[model samples]
Target chain A: MTRKWLRWMPAVAVPAVIAAAALAGSLPASAGDPLPAKTPAEVLALVAQHSAPSLSGTLEQTSRIGLPELPQAGPSSGSGGAASVLELLSGPHTTRVFLDGPSNVRVQVLDRFAERNAVRSGDQVWLYSSKDNTAMHLTLPADAGHTKDFGHYKHRDTGMHGVMPTPEELAGRLIAAADPTTEVAVHPEVNVAGRAAYNLVITPRTEGTLIGSVAVAVDGESGLPLSVELKARGQEEPAFKLAFTSLSLEAPDASLFAFSPPPGATVKEIEVPAHGTGHWGKGHWPKHGTESGVVPDAEDPAPVAPDAVPPDAVEPDAVAPDYRDPNGALARPTVTGTGWESVVEFPASPASAEADAMLSNDPLLQQAAVAVPGGRLFSTAVVNVLFTDDGRVFAGSVPAERLLTAAAAR
Target chain B: MPSREVPDREVPNRALPIREVAGTDGAADVGTAEPPSDRSSSGWPLLASELAVLFRRRRTWAMMLALAAVPVLMAIAVRASSAVPPGRGPAFLDRITQNGLFVGVTAMLVCVPLFLPLTVGVVAGDTIAGEAGLGTLRYLLVAPAGRVRLLLVKYAGAAGFCIVAPLVVALAGAGIGAALFPVGPVTLLSGDVITPEEAVVRLVLVAAYLTVSLLGLSAVGLFLSTLTDVPVGAMAATIVISVVSQVLGELPQLEWLHPWLFSHYWFGFADLLRQPIAWDAFGDNALLQAGYIAVFGALAYGRFVTKDILS
Candidate 1:
């Protein structure tokens, strides 16, 4: 009997040892964050001076925006699938991003059982959906900045935090627009992707704004933005987050930039006019974007027209030209108030019925919006858009009451 | 020798009664319950006997046939029907018509979620309990197999099933797919084309990955088998764990628990089909499986060595 129990020693010991090792592995590295002290301004400079021109990393994007739970995989997911802009917004997605500069960039949305890849090399862009085995090719005009031309992807893909803009681009916009109503401070150093980073927090000093603060982690060594997190006013959890889970500063294989549709793939060639003549140009809105700037991507920062905002003359309130919305049926889209509290107001469009129908007919709007006294308010953690009975639309990163007040005052 | 069905069960078990697994006979203690002396007998011959007993069972053959039918049925359906609209069905379903090689991949995908785990659960869960249930377990303990040796042989037999099941599905998939669809170059997920030889190599790699993925669950099943005398209970519990792990994996709320889930890397084998073949997930998955094996293998050892064997 003693011998029988003696044999049990290894069984118990082996598992116990493994458990101990696993416990050690799961604990975050206990080393102190090793970085010299830096002020908020210093961190801002770190970002401006930062240019890791070539790097490959995997980024995870997750949102708790309170959108209804949509089935993640459906028949439609196969064709447009997770790459569909709305689909991208709803769930957690892992994207592998490889950038060799403005000329060569490949972003792969790694969906289960399928992948949707957008690879841009020189003037050519290839969008391939592995699910359906279809590829779309577009050749850019010589004059349009490839960086700006990629905006068409975000332009059509309005909503969900500037459609895959790197943390650098998003954080750059926030820092550029910092004003008297903005409070920038450096939190204690934190670690991101195994790199020490200065956590720069940008708080909105103004009241009545949905934005609580935006925190960006700047890599201490490379000065690159490693992660960006946005929190709503009352929410303890970040409403939207994008961060690199793994990163490598080395340039990815040059061959990854080149894409040729496989032999059996059904490839479609998308036609674009040369340079400035096409709507795909930076200064122009892609055809669909002009139809509805109501996309939630329009809420924060300035509109898609960053250059349209005068270089040195940003209104103290940070109001620039409102985003393009040809279908809004209202010309003269304007902003009222200032700082983070600004509300974009569009007067009742001439075609009220069409605009009203557009609002009422939208499935997302109908599902997300709750009827108010005179309008329906569609609210997310970051943006609230109100559609009044008279076909006027008011939207901002402010409370629904603010939008209603603006509508009533109008 | 009333138990003629078990072949050479009695003498070997009595010849090498390990101190740990020597069973107390409630029905008939015919042989001396002596300390283990034939430790050297716990070698290749014992494992060979274990495997022969396993593979010779009609149930094992039936399960193998059922697994092989998955890809055959899938290929025949796709071939009989009009082209499945590109985005309408299971992931690689549409690709199968374009390239016969995809039938193996798609079949593996479909089976990994349920069928493969179910079969693995049966075989692994049957390890000790099936012997115990048949009343041969006690005899085998006295027959020549020490407790540790017998446990090793049982696990090896289950592990053997792990490799063979996926290979069966993959090879059967290839045969039927080639017969029905056109065989040619394969288009990888990265859109790179590879010769048929390379594609076959990739399929084998996929099979290898799947074998690793299921090995962890096999360990879990083996441990569960030792917990109960009824094989069916152990089998159900083992299969349930696989399903639950997959369900938890899909929940975004449990994102923290995901990296630890065994099923987390089940589909990552497709990374093998990428252009340069992303080895990161493969490495992570192998490490995770190894961890599972160590934890459960030890747990099974601890339980089986200490437990009283009455059958």
Candidate 2:
């Protein structure tokens, strides 16, 4: 009797699990929802009606990972300060747009490196390479025609794979697959971002993989994606969740899309790798603009508002006073031990072997490596003081150029 | 006589055939009294009992004692230091303990590419080799114990060492690290700081994951030990394999190749320290390591059970 029951146990468990999964995937749709009959184009058209050209906000992001019991990170909230956060609210296939805002009509495309990030504000799209100090700015063409077909994964045969599918694209595809035959529940609810949103869940019409259904919460008013949760065909728990924070719908200047190189700045055309083409996506930007144009000053060359503060509002008229002069926290150099003595100051550079040696030895100096990048590259220089008692023990970057300059001046 | 599990394909035709023996001492008169031969003559269970005897060695005790002392010493070092910049923090000492654990794990990691899987390789590397070097392998093999039992015994002893050594080192290191380093608030990669209790739990989890990761290497070592005569060669080979894999695992160009290598998951435990825990990478790492353990373990069992014990 026990042996017979054990054989039937597995058979009973499989069908029971299947039924439960089927029920879980097909949550009843609520009333007064009109999205059930819309195709991708029609769905996008509905989105375009209420959507604005641009959205901007302040973003404080904290990304972490690990098990729930022992998580990867603690909460770290850093202030983004007065900087404007921009995201162009668009459907998955809407890759490039000619947006007119704080600066007037230029081109904006979802940034591929930043995982299909929407471009919200600012005229010039500036990106700097950390490895090399090279910078690039992109501009929209005057015609603003859809010259390049973007966001078509199926059109790869025509040598056009613009970028990986956006989160909204995935959500749209899931919804479209389940439209007429199956009803998806759409609910208005608050998401992690503390904003009201329409939560949409799609259940496929046919038999499929474990994740036969998908759910996403889109900001109802902004048309921006706030969060997404996915359920597999068999599982009760969500397989994964992605959340976007600090959403807004403010308009941006149109001119922010136009890119003009500074005079004497070298302009080189580089080909960017297409997404989902192969491993390691391409990085080179399409080169069309020439460097002959006078580089606009870092200051806002074309101010949108009359009250718009100049970009370089914090610049001093003359060289700042040296605080090390008696009144400074470091008044006089106290002679501790007998050796080589002098206050030395130099900017941090990887090329400087001496600075590496000094910084590597002092634990406090390590943070300097990461800090230099967050600020203007040329703004602050590293001030180094060397007190060498045993010359043989520690020979600081022996051929000091600044020391040579001082010696030559004397 | 012994029941063998070696696949028929790998069994050499030139290998010696086993003869039936009536009693425990039946093979003694024929000079097949070596521990491994005796094990084959006796049985697998008897071999396991012999492994317990091998663990009773003074040298094994001393080695374990020394390894167990490292964390305590590390803890003392951390406690004695005046100001531990991030450089001097518990993480650094934790790294030091990691280095020591890696030495043992590397022994195992080295075996995956060439030798048997890691755990088998570690035991196999030292098994006959260590015994042969000590001139006890021949004696043990020739004793009432059969060759198979001797092999099993040695493997069991090594596995016991491998599991115990890492835990002791981790516990000692963490204990010392906690005592020596400032234990107030632990800063994490996510810019969130954790209290001492939370940090302790995370560290313990990290150590436990590391132990699981090392199991594959240990299995490989035991398997390799069966193939070689000198245990040092097996030991050296194991370490070399680990070093090479570690080097290969770091190349950015071959980032895709990383998921396949055993060492790829070595630092995965550190992910636990991150806030919210990045499980995508960690889960992938855990799955990969578990697969390695299963494959290496099966290979070791098949090889040891079937291979000719000429040594």
What are the Cα lDDT values of the candidates?
0.71, 0.38
**Residue pairs in steric clash, candidate 1?**
A77-A81, B12-B143, B12-B144, B13-B142, B13-B143, B13-B144, B14-B142, B14-B143, B16-B144
Q: What is the lDDT of residue A380 in candidate 1?
A: 72
Instruction: Indicate which candidate wins on DockQ.
Output: 1
Fraction of native Cα contacts reproduced by each candidate: 0.52, 0.00
Q: Best candidate per TM-score, number?
A: 1
Over A151-231, each residue of candidate 1 has an lDDT whose tens digit, in order, gives: 233322121223455676566666766778789999987777888889999888877777888889999999989988878
Q: How well is each residue in B137-204 modelled by candidate 2, as lDDT tens digits?
A: 44454344554455555655666655565555555555555444434555443233456567667656
lDDT of 2 by residue, A311-357 (tens): 11111211011112112322221212111212123222222233234
Error of 2 at A94 (Å): 26
Question: Could you tell me the lDDT of residue A202 within candidate 2?
Answer: 56
Docking level for model 1: acceptable
